[model samples]
Target chain A: MLAFRKVVEKMEGYVPGEQPQEKGFIKLNTNENPYPPPREVLKALQEKVTPERLALYPPPLSDQLRFKLSEVYGVPPDQIIVGNGSDELLNIIFRAFLGYRSRVAYLYPTYTLYRTLATIQEADYLEIPFQGEDFQQLPSRFLAEEADLKVVCNPNSPTGTFIPMEEIEKLLQSSRCPVVLDEAYVDFAEESALPLLPKYPHLIIVRTLSKSFSLAGLRIGFLFAHSEVVKGLLKLKDSYNVNILSQIAGVAALEGLNQVKENISKIKRTREWFSQALKSLGFQVLPSQANFVFVRSRSYESLEKVYQELKSRKILVRFFPEWKEWLRITIGKDQEMQILLENLKEILGKEWNQGA
Target chain B: MLAFRKVVEKMEGYVPGEQPQEKGFIKLNTNENPYPPPREVLKALQEKVTPERLALYPPPLSDQLRFKLSEVYGVPPDQIIVGNGSDELLNIIFRAFLGYRSRVAYLYPTYTLYRTLATIQEADYLEIPFQGEDFQQLPSRFLAEEADLKVVCNPNSPTGTFIPMEEIEKLLQSSRCPVVLDEAYVDFAEESALPLLPKYPHLIIVRTLSKSFSLAGLRIGFLFAHSEVVKGLLKLKDSYNVNILSQIAGVAALEGLNQVKENISKIKRTREWFSQALKSLGFQVLPSQANFVFVRSRSYESLEKVYQELKSRKILVRFFPEWKEWLRITIGKDQEMQILLENLKEILGKEWNQGA
Candidate 1:
């Protein structure tokens, strides 16, 4: 028999969504920003993230990127630790802060990856599904230390349900252990928990440059916590986790925050407009604080027909096999979203009046 | 006080060697190659590791890079796993294979990073120092399963010592646990354990592009193992551990293998010329199989004086505080080595030779 850890052997690994290559596809599968990143990104990479630096090892902590992120988030540089993606930050949190003997809790139908990360860390995993109060309030049984760590996906993934800040604060006040607030989609959310950094040392917020900055290609994600916890993550992180191109691009994106804001506004508008159009049909669209919206299929035939029609039209939307009925569509550019609606209308009904 | 894991709380983390950025300095501190990667690297970045791919999540196993590495090593893609660097690969091996309660061993004076990785993995750490005789012929005590895994830094770092392949085979036959041969600097070494990969299912050899391929700025490494172990690492790794740029450069470098061979030849030639010069100065130089030489200083003063003199003359080298009298110098371009020799000759006569 092969020599390997039982924990690793028994685990089914996490696989991310597909990036289909066929052109003319209105891709709304992965929740990526529809607009390009700040102008500074393309400009600087050709200049500063140049051939010479590519010959030497990049800075261990990526000092400049940390400083820029700290300035934007209003946190000290020492309290910031970055990763290849916000996913990597979450990996470090579970791997370093919590022991395998410790337990972790997250709501089901939230970011499903939390359970996968906890399992990989070999921790006791617990899930309190988003059943009662529409996932707004923490489960009553969870107020006590059911787990050593609790990960709350703010404006949670898949469902796009935005829980109020007060409930999170209340959970923090009574929770048995440290809490991680994953805000990967927070740029499109109503507000972020970054402002709460100073008040709560036990609260950790993870952010990514992927959605808002339009830089999913150059992997850059960061976690903000009490300096002590950040220090713990630093201790566990790979020395050269962030490459030079990313560090340079991250600094550029932060400096040109105006462009980032513009892009975010464009996406936010498209997201709202798309939500209204989806609801115009019989689909029940969840209130989303992310770049993507979750719509429940009214009729099983309609769901199957719409999915197949969109794919045939070279438009892609992610359908979860776990929750087979609901569809997750990323907010594409205005033109792309319009094409999706038109194609969707044709699939639902031939005429505009009959589309409902 | 923060409620972190007790393991990380008491841990004093490893500090990597300094990478200085002084103008006009001939940098031989870290063992980075002097040449830029072949032109194919830039071409691949522009043509393959694109902005579009970045927008979506990267392929988890990086099938393309794995396939390229497998072809180079004459193994199939299933038998390999890629990482941000061999450092991350080593971390995965410890977690997916060695339990925290299990013991792990390595050479004391070899890549000290192996011990650090093991400690971070919470494996019981064991080390056997480099004494006399060939590295392959470890002491009888090393074969015991008290250590669940052993890491052999082939053509070892700091002290460039090479062990015969037969000796490694002997250990695999005798030891109860798995053996990992870290070939991070193996391009500079005379031999590799890759040919024996087919026969030894327990062997896992880790390699990197940081040294010979001239892509230190791009942190990419690969692992070769039995398909079972490779799958195990994949299940345990962070999905996007290797970023877009590194993946692009890795394939190009693999395609340009002849260019890499030429680069390694130049480094080897320079290594020989410089080692002979050091030997003439009465320093005991280990016969290096890698692109660097580890020289023992007769005393702490000699080491300190040599280090200071090199610094003042705009030259840099790595000195281990733990092994205070040993200096590890990377083989630079022939002209850069000349600068180091001239600085060493003038300084040794002035300060290091004063007492002698």
Candidate 2:
């Protein structure tokens, strides 16, 4: 047998949300944006794809995109770094701060990929469970835990709940390690921790173009931090992390912010409408600041049956076995959600009649 | 001060060949293909770039490209893993086999990025010097050295020397650890070690589209190995490592092999003609199997002077301080090489007159 590293040999790989190969199913499991990216983004991609241009290596640090990001986000060019995705930035953070068996801490059930990265690095991690019923407040010990790195995914995944900026600042103030505030879904949320970067030297804010910008297929993300932190993280990233097409797509996506804002507003409206509709059917829906919602019903068995029936009927929504009775469903187009609600009512109604 | 890992704090980042931002230079520094990729590749990219397609995530493992690669190269689909570039594949290999303080072995003066990666991982490495004057043979102790991983760059960089397949097989036969055969430049060489995979489960061959296929800006690469090895490396890779446009570009590049072969043959012809031209000018040129030629002069000072003079004349070639008397020049189109030769003769004649 090949002698693979013990960490790699023993640890399970991070399984991303299933991307079904076959067509025609409503793909809501991965929380992908319901709308396509702005027309300008596609136009930019078309303009950039040429034989001569593709023959050269991309700019080492994606400087053009960084400059564009600096202009749009008000972050200094030196303070920003582009990555393959926020996933790559997270991996870089772990590699830069956490050596073998180094300590990392994050909230339990935020992004499972964090635990997988820690395991890959052979680093120890402390998962502090989020406090309160709606998963809003940070864990009491989160600020006090001593670790090399910490991660906070605002508008946390699978739950879609947001934490206030003040709470994030408190943790940043008290923590000695680099606190990564993952803002992957922050475009749809109330506020961002990016403004906190000036005050917190240890704060690393990561953003992605996948959600609100509707360029998930492009795999572009940004990390904003102090110049010193950015410099150190830069040492750990792949030399040509971002490709030419991605850099162009990112610039165009940022330029088309007006279109993105319209999409976000429509999704938010649909989210509220769908949440209330689910509540009418006697299911508890969390107030979400993300593109998706976390829904809980009265019975775990019935929820499982609902998940199975939805799958069979060609509606794809995320079902986490760890969070029993809870189903995370992405808010697609209004009409798609309407079809989903109609199908859900029939399934629940049939189950209720069977119970009677 | 924020605490970064000791390894990251002490390590220097890998400095890739300078990519000048300004235009209008001869541009032969980074070893990028002088010829543009096939028109079909760009057509494929244009066809793939749609607003709706850009909204969803790319296939996580680049399955379509892998299928195409398997069909073209006859490697089993399970044995092939696609990466952002062969550089990312190299990083994955380091992460998978060499944990913290684990040993990695490679030849000196091969790819400097190997050393940078070792430093980043905080792993110990043994650099065995290339044997003899021509660097056509592996180091004597290379096979016997105990290491967690070993890397061999066939048609090695900077030197442009090729080691025979028999020699590579000998190393593979003797080494107990995973042997990484980095064939980034192998497309320009005589033979490949790909057929040796069935006999040696520990052999991993890494190839790139950057050098030969001229998709350097797209960042597409492949790693062919045992299925088990691919599985372990997959655990360490980012979920969506290769983006959408790159996947399409790779598939189309493979389909356009006829055009690529014609380009490769032209480059080889230019490489030979350039080597002979430099030799006629009294510069010692290595017998190159790769797309570039390495030339050594009698004096390091004169070589430095030549490098500076060439830069002033708007021609760019790589000059490594460590390889004092030697300058590595990428073989460009015939007209570009003619211009370089014309300039070189003038500089040498001027220097000879001044010395006399």
Candidate 3:
């Protein structure tokens, strides 16, 4: 028998939101941008697909992308590192700081991939639950726990609830260990913890182009930190984590930020409208600062049935078993969201009329 | 102070071959394919750059690329896993099998990245040197050393010397532990250990499009192993390691194997010509099966002077500090090789006349 490390043997791989191969289904399960990236991004990609470009190795540290990100975000280029995706950045943090004897802490009902990564490293972790019902407040005990690494997914996934910047600062101030502020969905929100990077040398903010820039398929992500932290993480990263085309696409996406901003505005508007629509139908919808809304019905059984009904109708939304009564719905284009809303209303009304 | 893991603090990162920023140098430092990938690859990439594709998350495991590789390599689709590059695949293997308490072994003067990876994982590693000066035979002690994982870089880098499949089988037969046969440069060689995979369930064959397929910039690699091994490595890889463009490009490259085969034949032919040319110039060139030749001079001082002279003339080849008397030169286009040869002749002649 091939002897896999005990940790790998014991840990289950993270299941990303289902990406049905066949097209035409409403794909709100993964929170990808509902629109394409700016035309310039595609144009840049097309221009970059030459024989010479494809034959050479990419710039090892993605220097061009880092420079563009630095210019856009106001951080020095040396302090930033580009990754294959934000997932790679998160994994690097775990590998660099959290090991077998180290401990990691994150909020419960958050991005579950953190738990999977911590498990893979065989590190002890605390999945501290939110203190309140809205899933907005950080657990007080989470601040008190000592860990080698801490992660905060602002505008956290599955729930789409945003923790305030002040609250995130509190965590950064309380912990001396590395704090990975994953702002994968923060562009949809009002503020970012990127400003905290200079104040806290240990603050590593991870951002991806997937949700806001509409380049998820390109796999471009950035990590902003003190140069010292960046240097250490560089030691652990693959020599050329980001490929050539990705680096080119990332630069073009940043250059086309106006288009990305317009899309973010549209998604934000649709998120608000969708949240209100869900609430009007007697579902409790969390106030989302992301491109998705977390909704719950009063009954777990009925909510699960609604989930299945939506799936049957070829409209896919996210349903985590841990949050039995809650369903996470990504805000697609207005028309797609409208179709989803109509299906939800019919499913719930039919269930209510049946009185089962 | 931000406390990095002890392993990260102590370990120096892998320094990749120098990629000079400015153009116009006779670049042959890294062993990237001098030729461009097939035109079909660029066409596939261009066609894949639509907004809808960019907005969507790539298929998590790159199913299409895997299927294409399966068709070409005759391996089951389930047994093949694609990665950002073979570098990522190697990292996954090190993470899955070799950890803090485990041990790894690889040939000395092989790809040094393996040692760096083991060091990052804080695992003990044994660097078994090749038994002979020609670097054709594997060290006798390598088969005896019990390790959790053993890596063999076929047509090993820097030296470009290949171990025959039968010799590799001897190592596989003696060890029950996982053996990773990295065939990154194998397409340029005469044979691969892939055919042995069926007999040795523990054998993992890693191949990359970077060298032979001329898609290094696209970062596509394939790992072929038993489904059981693939399953374990999957747990450690990022959810979407290969981006959409890379996957599309990989499939197209595989489809255009005829072009790639022609390029490989050209590189091999160039390798032989360059080796013979170097030998005529009083340089000892290793019998190279890969696209690069390892050339050494009898005097370290004179070789160092020659390397500097080549660099001064805007010609770049690889000079490793560890191998002070040796220089690893990548075979470029026939014309590029001709230019490199001319420069070497001039430098050596000047030094001989100077008699210093």
Interface RMSD score of each model: 1.9, 0.9, 0.9
Docking class for model 3 is high
Scoring each candidate complex against the real one, what DockQ results? 0.57, 0.84, 0.85
Q: Say what the RMSD of model 2 is.
A: 1.8
Badly placed stretches (over 4 Å) of model 1 are: A21-24, A131-133, A301-313, A343-356, B46-51, B131-136, B144-147, B301-305, B352-356
lDDT of 1 by residue, B32-148 (tens): 888877778866775664445556556667777888887777889988888887788888888877767777887767777776667766778887876574344566666554567
How far in Å is the alpha carbon of A89 misplaced in model 3? 0.6
Ranking by TM-score: 3, 2, 1
* Residue lDDT tens for model 1, A152-217: 898788878787887788888887577899998888878878777788888999989988888776
Candidate 1: which pairs clash? A217-B54
Predictions: Cα RMSD each = 3.1, 1.8, 1.6
Per-residue accuracy of model 3 over B78-164 as CA lDDT, tens digit each: 999999999999999999998886899899898989989999888999999898887878777998889999999998998999998
lDDT of 3 by residue, A62-149 (tens): 9888999989999999999999999999999899998886899998888999998889888998888888878778787888889899
Model 2 bad stretches (over 4 Å): A352-356, B352-356
Candidate 2 chain A least-lDDT 10 residues: A297-306
**lDDT value for model 1:** 0.79
Give the share of true interchain contacts found in each model: 0.56, 0.85, 0.87
